[model samples]
Target: MASAPLNEVCLAALTLSIVFLTILWYKLTSNISHKEESRLPPGPRGLPIVGFLTFLRPNLHHQLTELSQHYGPIYKLWLGSKLCVVLNSPSLAKEVVRDQDSVFANRDPPIAGLVATYGGIDIGFSPYGSYWRDMRKLFVREMLSNRNLEASYSLRRHEVRKTIRNVHTKIGNLINIFELACVTKMNVVMSTMFDSNFVEKHRIDGAEFRELVVKFLQVMGKPNISDFFPMLARFDLQGIQKEMEAVLKSVDSILDPAINERMKMLSEGEIWGKGKKDFLQILLELMEQKDIEISVDLVKIKAILVDIMIGGTDTTITTIEWVMTELLNNPEIMGKVQRELKDVVGMNNIVEESHIPNLHYLDAVLKETLRLHPALPLLLPKRPSQSAVVGGYTIPKGTKVFLNVYAIHRDPQVWESPLEFQPERFLNSTNLDYAGNNMKYLPFGSGRRVCAGLPLAEKILMLILASLLHSYDWKLPEGENVDLSEEFGLVIKKSKSLFAIPTPRLPNFELYQ
Candidate 1:
């Protein structure tokens, strides 16, 4: 009787344990399924805690491209605690960035922007508001207006000549044209912004400024742990804020001296009396005008300089480098462009700004290059100012949105054989510019915050590209193939440095002198 009672007690304990486990498993699975069905876009399920982070590779574009194949155009992925919705088609991108532009016009204040701009006070990161409107208007009217363009024309022409001379001197030697392009572009912007030039004998802090700008761009482009986790944002989890602050300090050190010098000149009536016209001079004039306070912190001044440095240098150079690389890799296309340049500008003359308009084939090549490798493969992240529905999904207010320009550009549905580098496609099409009206090409972005420097950048790039093509026939160094692989940061850069050998064309030989 005692043995039977003991066996019954053991049996009861085993049965209860099994029943409890079954209930717990059911509840956990049920909760997960419910969460999954709550209307999030299709995506690969990720592992616990770390999410899909481990799956991400160094070449983020490739990783995203592959994921889009399996997950459709609009897909979701978790980076740590944050949910990222990537728009993969041109139409979808237009929906988010164009059709609903106002709803998504606000910028997501990245850690770098916050620190660099002193908490989103700068034009680039300032949320969509009255202040941003005011600053943007100032940028447009004073800095990039036609008057400013005319003022800077002489400096641009001089820089173009300097670049040609540099290339002419390097005729038989292997040269990294990308580096040359960067230096030349920087000099042009510097000359216009400050009355200084990057002469061989007069090194006016160009190296220091270049170093600081590069550092700032790299740090700002890094993936921040704080960005993905809202809880850790305030803590600056990955030390991004610290890194940014250090860069900002370096930038301010260089900028403040220039600003102070200009201020002193203004107080002394040196600028007004001389009747000089420079970017700084123009801005000072605006600052003094009635109805404009010009904020004591000099936010407008710093912001304009930052915009020039950020907007002016890397992007234009990168575009030129990519175009040159593509042309070199595909000689047929290059030959066509060269022929066009020769026909339009003629071999006897240098390609001046006046010549750019007539170089249709060269313009097409530039558009094609931008289509393939937009500087910001994913343009700056935009945040929703208010809750809205996009493609049937509710986007909560403050949700970060990104238009994947890379994916959109590469989509086969939009362009036949999208991977091919055929500039002819652009020649055949009526729509070829970066204005928001055209969804197919948005290298300069679109809508309210479209790049302020678009006109200047386009003019400079076209002139430089046409001039180089008109002046020289270029070849890749050695037997190496020109690599089209890309790396992304604040801007996308070639994975390998593009080195080439340039031989001056006989027709444009006189221009080199």
Candidate 2:
């Protein structure tokens, strides 16, 4: 008696119900059979085949945080066929990163990242073993060492001062804050790495380089069909792999010339590392000094350079933008930062690198900003090399582990009014340090595979935020309000770029120039 469409709908519903019930039954039996050996972590029983894919939210971090409330601190989700474990508490995070660090040091680099990172040879997401250790040491010792960073301070200072002068030129005009931050950070990075400055270089447009970086970042963050389903990876169903490769081509074009020039300089014995050591010179010297125990090849050098360039720029740019957004949204907090800067550096003077440490309130503001909006909210997905037990449950080998530090930072048990923006919490905190010693507050991640550029990242971010606040008063354009909404991707960025008007507060025009 029913129409044909109605009959088809009824049949489909019945089929789906049977499939769902059958999957649940299978899981129950499988668990019972393996119960004596190992207990699997508890999680939602999703639909057959696709698993929990249908329930995925646009903001994956929030969804994972919400799931934590129901599944407890440690829970699993079947994301399109891949088994994912989400750790929502500091203790659980400590167990994985600290208590049993080596076991989980392996990385399952996403499909897009694999192409972007040139097949996972880079330090950050490389597999756990000798190669990763070698690269990390080379980066920390040769490039990012305190001595090297100190030597490069003048380069960094030059870039920041140049940015201030440019900002001074357009004193009350509406400008994109993220663009400004990107160019400044790019200038510093280029100057330090290749003895080049974006502001001074007219041949290469700053906007072009900025666009390439943003595009590459978006690709790295995009949810590729291949990452969720390994079987689909070879097909390149969504073209994400191809797209990432293209972005890499553009980036490599920029980096290739620098690498070649350094190579030629080293071969010609031109006294490359005699003074003002750039990262390229350090790597070249290591490569030439065959007596050195560590490994340094041209391939490794380029890989590390790409890693530094991508990692350094995005994190600082996003942090500056977010800190400014939060401060603008809360004028009282903005006033507090200005007062601290005034007391430390004086109202007539602009902030400098040395004055940064003296401004404790500014430190609190930076820490608070990091806590609220971590650049990598999920913090570079880590993988287990072998089966491991966590929180009394068996975690199967190769399960992608998402250490939800963002969730942990917002845990009501750990922070008071966790959702509210409060920098005072960090004003005198003894336990919390960005060094990853405190499991609850690892802005740069914790353990062996942590971010290699932490020292520079901290210095650059703090100085940028402090200098900007000390120099100007900012306001949104007419009818435009600050939007604190965030977009989750490879890096968490504001849904919109922060565009505001800047007014110079300095008494002297000489300082601006």
Candidate 3:
């Protein structure tokens, strides 16, 4: 009788505890529901499981802009299992990029970017940490520093002049503007990274490097189904990841030998750049230095090198092509740019790098082209590190954020006639810069994650564009019209290749030599 009574008491206690726990759970869930109702950015209702995967468009930037109109500036979309936030307005973008820069500085690069960047070892995609900070510091202070650029001026000058001379030969022929720019830019990038003589020696062997860059970028920018569904990535469902690997293998074939040669040179105490080191020399020195703050291996060095090589080439070359295309499309703007060129850098002599700053109208034209055709229209996607509130909505952590600068740059509220190419709009706006400070115009993005190569890109772009406009007058190939329609990719490229004919405007052809 005594044992039976104890068992009954234990059972009654268990039932009471279960009831109490259930009441506690209900209260917690009700509070969570209330909190969720107030938070969570408004967006299109997505389907179960897949969310907005089915709604993705080929022209994502345009589609996102259109979506912003209906969903408001800050909106959310679920791509497969991923939560993506689109920041359309400058104010919204400012929150993610500026106010919460530390939280959102991390990038959510696609699989291809990861593979191309050696699994995020480079400064481009590396998390905001000691390694990234040190690498960036070294790159800015040593590699792409003003002093280093000045030291390498002759090489930049040589490559630009070489391109001019080559174009002079093909003056009457229809020149593929992007191809010309790509090759010329690549030449400069190679020389800047290594040695000019080193590039000259390896040009024949590295011919395929050009094609590899084109393919790598195509693969890097192409949308992959795997990125939306991480589970599908390993299967190579879209084949984008596989193709990127193949292109990288080819790129490695070129880079390995070149890097090995550089290593040998460093080991032999040749000091390729002497006292004024190139990127390769500086990187090699870092590897040899024992007291270096950042611990970087060969792989990290190579990844950083690739970032610089690809980043340096694509931004300048593609933007230069667009600048030419815009100038060609708008004859009035073209005349204005040429007149400014003539005034700042006379027809009596070829333009020098020093003349770049004085050509205000040309700068306006360049800026105008960028406004229309930002290299990355939706600047590289960023990922918030933790759950955060943005624009009065709770943006859950790890959500992919795309700041639609293209849309912001062309917003009707911001500009008088946003769609039309108007370089004059920027004529008096000396405060406006591409450095991401002005949210109204962030060609290079903003905040901590702003493009690491902005300084170099600015200098190279101004120099190259100024040189071309000053040295030559361009025409459409006999019976062709310029196509301003965009072909979106890693870089926003022209819908069709610009085939323009060039005629020398300089009094002395020898200046090109």
Tens-digit lDDT track of model 1 for 1-513: 899989999999978955664553344334323443476577778755445877888877768878889888777776655556777777777787778988888888677778877777777888887888888887777677887777777778777788898889888898887888888888777766766532332345877777777888788788887776555577786888998998988888877777777788778876431333567667766777777634424766777778777765788988899999999989999999889877877777777888777888888889989989988887887877776666666555665677778887888888889999988888877766867567877887888888877888888998788878888899877778879888866778998889999898955456797
Q: Candidate 1: deviation at residue 17, Å? A: 31
**What are the runs in model 1 whose C-alpha is more than 4 Å off?**
1-37, 197-203, 271-276, 292-297, 506-510
Deviation of model 1 at 393, angstroms: 1.7
Model 1 per-residue lDDT at 485: 84
Task: Score each candidate by Cα lDDT.
Answer: 0.77, 0.82, 0.81
Candidate 2 off by > 4 Å: 1-38, 197-205, 269-274, 478-480
Clashes of 3: 0
Better of 2 and 3 by lDDT: 2
**lDDT accuracy of residue 387 in candidate 3:** 77
Q: Lowest summed lDDT over 10 consecutive residues: which window, candidate 2?
A: 28-37
The better-scoring model by TM-score among 1 and 3 is: 3
Which numbered prediction scores highest in lDDT against the true structure? 2
Kindly give the number of clashing pairs for every candidate: 1, 1, 0
Clashing pairs in 3: none
Question: What's the TM-score of each model vs. the native?
Answer: 0.88, 0.90, 0.89
Question: Cα RMSD (Å) per model?
Answer: 8.1, 4.4, 10.0
